[model samples]
Target: MTRARRKPMVAPKLFSEIDRYDEANSARLGLICIQERIPSGYTRWDREYNLDGRDARLTCISPGEYGGVPHGLDGDFATLLNVLYLEQGSPESGEVHTTAYQLIQRAGFPDSGQYYQSLQESLDRLKGATYTASESWRDHRQKRWTTVKFNIIEQIDSDTEGGTAFGVGTTLKIRLARPVVQSLRERYVKPLDLTFVMSLKRSLTRSLYRMLDAHRYDPANPQEPAAALRLPLLQWARECKLVEEVPARVRRNLESAHAELIDRGYLKSVTYEGRRAETIIVYEFGDLPATAPAPEPMIEVVPDSPVTEALRRRGVAHPVARRLVADFGENHVTVRLETFEAMIAAGYKARNPSALLVDVIKDQEGKYAALGTSALPAAVAPHARISKVVGDEDVDALSATLDTEFRALPPAEQAARAVTSVRMFIGKELREGHYRSLLRAVQAGDVDALELQREATRAAAELRLPEFAEGLRRAYSEP
Candidate 1:
C-alpha cells in the first residue's frame, strides 16, 4: 500500500522586530489612519494628517492611488514589516521570501479560505497605498525637519497555482520600499513584544499598544520613565474617530480603553489633568505591582465647594483635598468626611488627619470593587507574605550588598554579576502564595490562565520576580 505524503510541520515564528516608534508614534499623533475593515471595493483620495507634539511635528499625506489614507494597513502591513525585519539577512537586502502560510501564521491570522482572501486584499491595498511623511524635531540646541515618501511594498513576486487550495503551494517574495528599510538600518527602531502586539484583537487597542511600546523608556537607563503623552481631549477624540462625540461620551470611551489596556498590563495608569472639554489625558506606561491601590472613580464635584471646605477642616492639604473631591465625587467624599467627623466627635484626638483619611479609604478595599475597575493609584497594598520575602528593606539591603560586591570584583565579573542579580531578583516573588491564588482563579474559571500568566509576568518585572513568574506560567500550562 502506498502512503500519502504528509505536510512538514512549521515552527512558530513567535517574534518579530520593527522600528517600534515608526508607525506607532505616527498613529498616536494621528498620522497613520486605521479603519475597522476594508471597503467592499476600491476607492482613492488624497488627504493630509498632522501629528503635533511639544517638540516635534509629523505630517502624513495619503497618495491618491489607494483609498484615502491606508485604512486597516497598520495591522497586516505591520505584520509584514515585522516578518521582513526579522528575516532580513542584511540592511541592504530588501527582498524577503515567505510562503502565504508562513505569513498567515506569523501575522496571527487563521489559516482559512477567508483569511487567505483577506490577506490577498490587504496585499493589494498595501501595494497601491503610499504616503509622504514630514518629520520635525526640535530642542534647546537645535531643530531639524525632513520629508520622505514611500510605498508600503515596492514590489511583490509570487508563485502559486490559481487553485482552491487555500494558500497551498503559494510563495511570496516581497521587497520593502527604501525609506522604511533605511529607517530600520539607521537604528530608528524600538524593541517590541511581537507576541503581545499580535494578540490584541481590536485595531485601536493594537495601535495604542504600539504607541506605548514605541514610547517606553529603556529600563536599563536608570532614569525616570519618559514623560506621559499629554494630548488635548478634543484632539485625542478626533484621532480616535470620536470627533462627533460629546465630551462625556469621549471620556467614557477613553476610560474604557484605559481600563482594557491596564487589564492587559500595558498601562501603569491613566490620569486627566482637567475636567470636561479642557481635559488633558496623560498615558503613563510602566510595570505596576499587583497589589497597588485602586484609583478613585471619576465623578462630578464643584470646584471650591463645601466638600473641599470639610476636607480642609480635617487638615487635608488644599491640593490633596481638591484632587480627592474631583476624582472621588462629592457623595463619596461626604461619606468619608462624615465618618472622620464622627470619629473626631467621639473625643478622638488625631495628629495627622491627612494620613488617617488615606488609611481609612485604603482600609475600605472593597469600596470600588463592585465597579469592576482596574486602573488604580500606585499606593502599595499591604501583602504580609510578599512583604516578608521582597520588602523594601530586603531590596535596599540587596542593593547595598551588590554595590559593595561590585567594588571588589574585576570589571568582567562585575558585569556578569550585575546581570545575574537582576535575573535572580525577578524570580524572588515565587516564594509567596500569589501564584497559588492565580492558579486557583484560573482553574475556577474566574480568569483565563494565559491572561493571568501575562499579568504575572508584567507584575514580576516590576516586583523583580521573573523566575517566579516563569514557574507560575509553567504551572498554568502544564497538566
Candidate 2:
C-alpha cells in the first residue's frame, strides 16, 4: 500500500500560493521580482518589444497585482505564467511564451489530480470557466506555443550589460502615473508649513551671526567666540521664532553676512572701549532696520564743585558724574572707588562696562523683558486697582513680582489675557454689556482661544510671537 501522503506543517496562508508561484516562475524564466512602484521592472515588463505591448492584461501583471483568485474554483491548482523573453525581438517577429500550468504535489493536496491535469484538459476547463484570458490568443502553426496580444511593455537589452537596453527612465516619462496632488493638498500642505517653521531655528542662528558681525566685532575665541554678542542676539532670535543650538556653521554664515553689511556701510563702528589705540568699537549693519534706540538714563546733575570742570575735559557724561556723586557724595569718593577697584582687578572690570552698557540699553529700551512686563502688566495693572510699594533698594522687585505672576499662570490663560489686553477696553467694552457674553463665549470652549494658546506657545517657545503670528493665523482660521 502507498504510504500516506505527508501533511503540510501549517494551514494555507494568504499570498503563500502567490509567493510560491512568483518565486518559482521568476527563477525558472529569469523574471525579476521588483517592487510595484519601484523605479525599475522586469525584461518583458519594460513594454517596447512584447506582442501584448499595449494590452491591459499585460500591464496589470507587469507592475504586479495582488488579491487572490476566487474560492469557487475549489481545489483547482492552475496558474498562467506569462514570460516575454526580451532576448527575442518584436511582436510580429520575436518568441513570446504564455504557458498554463496545473500545479500538483503540494503536500496538502495529495489526492487532487482533478486540480492538476494535462495542459489540454487545463485549457478546456479554463475555456469552460467564465474567466478566459482577457485578450485574443492565437496558436502558432510554425512554433510550439501560442501568442497573445496583451498589454505588455517590452525593451531591447544592450550587450554592454549582458542584455538588451530597455530605456526604463524614458518609458516612465511617457507613461508614468501619479496620485492626484489636489486630493492631498490640505492634509499634506498644512503640517508641512507648521514643520517648516520648526525647521527654521537653524536658519535663524545664521541671521544672529550676521547681526553680530554688522558691528565690526570678531569672536575672540571659540569657547566664548560669541560671548560679546550672544545674549541679545539670542533674545531677538527667540522673538523671531529662532532658538539656540543653531549649528556653528550657521553662526559663521550669519557672521559673514553681517560682515558684508559692514562692507556696504550700512553699519559703522560708533564707539571705542579701552585705550584709544587698543579699543574696539562695534556698529550695527545698515542693511537691517534699526530697532528703537536703546534707553539711556537721562540724569542731569551739575556739580557745584570746581572739580566738575576738571572731569568735563574728559569724555565722561554728566549722568556718570551724577551716578558717581549719587553713589559717593564727593568727587574724591568716585575717584577712590575707581582707584580701589582698578588696584584690585587692574582695569578688567572697568574695561567691559561700555559693552555691558550696550546690553543695559537694549534691556531698558523694553525689548528684552516685555513678555513678563510692559504690555502684559499694563493690561491688568489699570483694572486691578492694587498698588504694591516698590523700592529701588530691591531694584527690579516690581517687575519681578509681575513676572512671577505671568509665569505662574498656564500658557493658555496668558494668551487669552494677551489678546484681551491688546483688543479690549474694559469699561468701554465691558460697560457695553456684550463683553461678558464674549468672554463667556471664549471661556465656553472656544476653538479660536485654544488655537491662540497653541500659537502663543509656539511663538514663545520658538520666539516668533506676534511677528510670526500673522503667518500662522490662516493656519487655524481658514474655512
Candidate 3:
C-alpha cells in the first residue's frame, strides 16, 4: 500500500482595520464619482436595457445604463460606488470613472470579493425617473471634447436602508463580516434561520457593540440556580447595560430563560412591572448607568380660526380655551370639534357639552362648516349633491377630513402642515355614508375605514400632495 500525500490548507488573509471602518460606515465596497463623456456618434443605444429604451432618445450622454447606481440611504453610497466599478469596468473599456475600491482593498479584507458583490447588486437594482447629463468644455475652441456629467435620482429601498427606531437615538449601521456570519452559522442558526437572520440582521446588529458593552454581565455571582453559558450572547448582552432596549417580542422570550442567565452570572437583576426582580446572584461586574430615556417630541397645537364672541361672553376657563385655541388653530371650528373629540378619547371622561356647541359655529363671514356625523345623509350620494348641501368639494373635503383625523393624534408640529397638503389620497373609497364618518372611524381604530375616506378623494390630475401623502402614510403606518 502507498501512503497518500496530504495537502495543507492555506491560511486566510487577516481582516483589516479599514474593513472594520467600512462595516461601521456601511461603506465597505467604496464610492465613485462617475463622469461619462460621449461624442455624438453611432454608439449603440440599447433600448432593451433602459427603462424607456425605445422612447428615450440618445444624446451625447445616452440612456444605455439606467440601473447602475448606488442607492438606499446615505452611507450605502459606498456600496453603490462599489457596484458601479464592477458593472461598468474601467477607462480600459473607454468609460470615464473614478473609485475608492483600490484604497479600501489596501486596508486588508479577506472577503473583499463579497463586499464588492454587495455593492454590485445594490447598484444594479437602481431605477431612475429621469436622466440628465451636462455637456461643457473648459477650452471649447482648443479641445473640442465634451465634459459631460450625468445627474441621477436613484430609487431607495426603505427596508434595507438604515433607520433610527426612537428617531432621537444615533443610527446603527450594520455590516456583518464573513467571519461573524460563519460564527452565527455554527451556532443554533440553521438554513431557515439564515433566511430569518438575514432579514433582521441588518437592523438588529449594526453598531450594536457599544450598546452590548453597556449591558455586559460580570462573572462573580450567580442569581439563578439553572444558569448556563450556552445561551445566546445577545440575551446576556440585553440583560447587561450594553443594549438597553430590545423589541417587545424578544423581551418576552428572554423572560423564560432569564433565571438561567442569573445562574450563570450573566445577569444581576431584571426589571419588570414597576419592580426589580433579582435573577443573577452576582453584582461584582460593576453597574452601568441606566439607559437614557428617549425624549418626547414637543407639540404646538393651534386653532385654525377665531372663536365666536358669544363664547367669549360665556367666559369659559381661560387656560382651557387657550389650550384649545393653540391646538385646533384659529379659523377652524371643524378642527375645534375634532380637538374636543381628541381630548375625550385621551381620557378626559367628564365631557364638556359647551365645547361641542362652540365647535359647530355658523361662521359669521359664511365660510363653510362640516356637519357632525349625526348630520350625515343616510345613503350613497354623488359628489355634486354632497358639495351643494354640505360644501364638501373634493379638495376641501380632503383637507377637512385629514385635519380632523390627524390633528387629533399626537403628531409633531411639522406634521400638521404636511398632512393637510394633499388634495386627496388613493385610500378614500372605503367609507359609505360620509367623509366625517371615516374620520371618526379612524379615531375608533377602524383602519380600513380611514383608507376608504382617502380613496373617495383620489383625483385624476397632477397633485401638490407629496408632502401630505408622506405624513398621512407615516400616521397610518404600523410601528
Q: Give me the candidate number with maximum lDDT.
A: 1
TM-score (all chains, Cα) for each model: 0.46, 0.14, 0.16
| Superior candidate under TM-score, 1 versus 3 | 1
Model 2, span 131-181: residue lDDT tens = 222331222123221323222112221111113222111010010001111
lDDT of 1 by residue, 41-154 (tens): 424333334425323334334444444445553455555564454323212455555556566666676556666676665665566665555453211122233456666678
Please report how far candidate 3 places residue 454 from its true position, in Å.
Answer: 9.9
RMSD of each: 22.4, 37.4, 27.7
Native-vs-model 3 lDDT? 0.27
TM-score of 1: 0.46
What ranges in model 1 sit over 4 Å off?
A: 1-31, 38-68, 136-144, 163-166, 215-227, 238-256, 286-479
The candidate, 1 or 2, that scores higher on TM-score is 1
Task: Report the C-alpha lDDT of model 3 over 1-479, residue by residue, as the tens digit.
Answer: 32322222222111110011111111111111111122223222211111112221212222334333222221233333322222221111111122223212221222243443443343332222122212211121242212232222232211111231211111111222222122222211101111111122122221121122222212111011121123233333332212123435345534444443333333455443221232322222112223542121111122223453333333332223443444444544434344334433444332223432342322211112333333322221111232444355653765666657544533221121122112123223222223223233343454443243333223111121344345445544433
What is the lDDT, from 0 to 100, of the residue 418 in candidate 3?
22
Q: Between candidates 2 and 3, name the one with more favorable TM-score.
A: 3
Off by over 4 Å in 2: 1-256, 263-265, 268-415, 418-440, 443-479
